[model samples]
Target: MSSKIYSVITGTGIYLPKKKVKNEAFLDFKFFESNGKPVERPNEYIVDKFQEITTIQERRYVADDLVASDIGFFAAKKAIEDAAIDPETLDYIIVAHNFGDVKFGSNRSDMVPALAARVKHKLKIKNPDCVAYDVPFGCPGWLQGMIQADYFIKSGDAKKVLVIGAETISRVIDLHDRDSMIYADGAGATILEGKESSSPVGILTHKTRSDTYRYAEMLTMGCSYNVTEKNKNDLYLKMNGRRLYQYALETVPLSIKACLDKAGKDIMQVNKVLIHQANGKMDDAIIERLYKLYEIDEVPKGVMPMIISWIGNSSVATVPTLLDLILKGSVENQEIKPGDLVVFASVGAGMNINAAVYQF
Candidate 1:
């Protein structure tokens, strides 16, 4: 009989930029009507609306000279230290991002120099055998990278992998668009180690699905759906909030339930449900729906922890950053213990959705 080799998440780290921008900061920003005419809403009214929808009161922004990979490297360093693993001992370095190395305050990105490679160089890892790569799987990128690391461990292709999700998404948001209120900037990371275990623990089950066929146009960049010409060349992100909210409320819960079912567990066994910190209200509604699927009437507090109120959605970086904060006790009264069941889930840009069941 062969012993099971489990991929365990040994450590986690996150990096938030120094600058914080309050919701009130957007008061002077103009909002346009469908006809391109400026809306007449008061500044306080707009700020309150944003708070009601996203539950986000502020978000961080990177310095104008910094890039996504720079923050990623910082998070990775802390994760490696937390794991007590030598950087040169890592077998693979996987970076998950959407805009690549997006320079703060600019739409331009330097993709030729891959973000993973940049992180490796910044870490001063000397081993040529420590292969590095990137995964651009929308906002679910970090969770997906963790899934891929599990695969490598199971296949005996790698013993240790470093996975990071980082982004300067604020650089991609259209300041004139309301969607900008939901986007921010940050980075997070984890180290996965392969170890032989007697029990069935670590990453148990995971599933990913995309609805690009029907919803590809629901969220996108480089122009609005019906408008063109000057806006055609615009490179900022634009989303149909109504469609996105509807899709998330319907799809994300099913994905979580399906993933837990595959692991031979029920919702009652879950200790924590760490979802992508997208919108405060939308996330709350999704969790409420999840409880209903199991026929539970009420959604308990502290079961799902939220950081979006202080740090808006940084795309791929959301999950890991939230996890790290909770684990470190930075978020009061929330913690993950050994042998606890933790379910991770997220949905975003590709119209891609994913969930995973893990034993911590």
Candidate 2:
């Protein structure tokens, strides 16, 4: 029998900015009236409500000198080192991002030179045949890139791929916007290489779904609505928390279960569930519902590890960062052993949801 070939994640890396913004920093944040009058909420009220909703205590922001691609290059270098692979041998470089790279202090997004191409240049990979591209699937873009790598390996079209998710979201967020508190800057990457194997040891199956018609506007980046703001032209992320909350509550759990079903695995077989670090409460609720779907009376502890409280949401970077942390034992008391089933899932701005089943 022909041996099975699998695209397995050989290594992972992450880059988080040096600056950390704590919840208290938002105490003086201004909320404007329709007339553009500055209205201030008490610090306690603001922090309490934010914690109650998103459960984020702090997040990171890029240094004044760096851009998203710069951050991603650092991560890519480390990922290549971890994988112990020469950059010249990479078959492809897939970069997933939302805002290409908002220049240090401006919202001017640079897209002419794609982030992947920039990283490839920065890595100094000499092979012109090493293809590089970007995927902008909102927050799930990184996972989508990894999924694409899996298919490439499966089709004999590629041998090794570098998948990266990086974002400098702080640049796109309005300083006065409440949603600003929920966004951060960071990057994560994984090196996937095709290898011949007898058993499934890599990406098994995945399910991706989108509902743009219904939730397209739920989370968006656009000009500030406040007429009082000096720069109405300034764009920032705006989200309808209630709508997104409802949508995630309804869609994510089922998407995960469906992915597991596609992989012909039971819920109990999954050792780690690395979900998008979007919201703490929402993630907890989703895990609970997933357990209920399997008719389990109690949710297992450590099944879902969350870093949102400290990292906030770095869009596409969340899952890979969290995965890298756990894989490297940076996360206390958590580790993924060989032969363990690891499930990766996320829901993002495209109103897109995706889940992939993998054997570690």
Candidate 3:
């Protein structure tokens, strides 16, 4: 019998920006409501509340000299080197980002040639056969790109693909919004190489669902909450935090369960759940509910290794960054080995949620 082919994650890398933004950084900034009203609370009290919920004490921010694609290239380079493959050998370069490259001090998004193409150029790969493109699926973009790479490999259309998720949320946030503290900048990349085997070993099953009917506007771009601001062309990332939290808790767990079931694997069989680091508290709730779906009471310790407390939420970059960190033993007490069953899941803008179950 002919063996089936699958795309497995063979190498991973991440680029963390040099600037570390602490919660205290916003102490002097005036926060306001969407309706042009002051928050009325002291900055310290607000910061404390934000930390209690998101658990993000600090997050990385790119230097003014860098942007999303810059970091994406850095991460892609490391992943390519880690895989120890010539860049020209890659069949595809898929970059996952929302705003392309929002330059420092500029609210504009620039993606004329596409970020993937830029990364390809930066990598200096001369192969014309290598296809490069972008995936704009919000926070789940990286995993979605991975799924696409798997399909390309499964169809015998590609051999090795680079999937990267890089975002600079810091550049698109309204300074007056307390939720801005949750934003950060970073990039992560994964190298997926195709392999044929007698049995399935990589990218077993995945699922995705979009809730645009009622949740499309949960996270959107809007003018600064600081009504006194003069610049109208400047847009910032905005969110209805209350609704987003409720939506994620309700759907993210179910999406993960469905993916595991499709893979014929249960929650207990999984060693890790690398979920998007949006809110630490919300992630904990999602896992708790995920365990409850399988009639389990307590979530296994170390099943989900988190970096949000120190990395904040870098939109699409979170999951891949977490995976890279864990694989390199950078995440304390969190590690994965050969044959470990793992799950990657995320929820973000588009009201989108997705999960992929794999055997590592």
Indicate which candidate wins on lDDT: 3
lDDT of 3 by residue, 24-73 (tens): 98899999988879999999999999999999999999999998999999
Q: Pairs clashing in candidate 1? A: none
Candidate 1, residues 99-198, lDDT tens digits: the string is 8887654586678788999999999999999999999888999999999999999999999999999999888777777678888999999999998988
Q: Cα deviation of 181 in candidate 1 (Å)?
A: 1.0
After TM-score superposition, what is the CA distance of residue 47 in candidate 1 from its true location, in Å?
Answer: 1.3
Ten-residue segment with the worst summed lDDT in candidate 3? 225-234
List clashing residue pairs in candidate 3.
Answer: none
Put down candidate 2 lDDT per residue, 1-360, tens digits, no spaces: 567998899989999898999999888777653345564666578678988889999999999999989999999999999999999999999999988978876887888699999999999998998999999998999999999999998999899999999999999877665667899999999999998988788999999998988788888876654654567777777788788988998999999999999999999999999999999999998888888899996887899998999999999999999999998988888899999999999998879999999998
Question: Which runs of model 2 end up more than 4 angstroms from their true locations?
Answer: 33-40
lDDT of 3 at 288: 99
Q: TM-score of model 1 relative to the true fold?
A: 0.96
lDDT scores in order: 0.90, 0.90, 0.92
Best by TM-score: 3
TM-score of each: 0.96, 0.97, 0.98
Candidate 3 accuracy as lDDT: 0.92
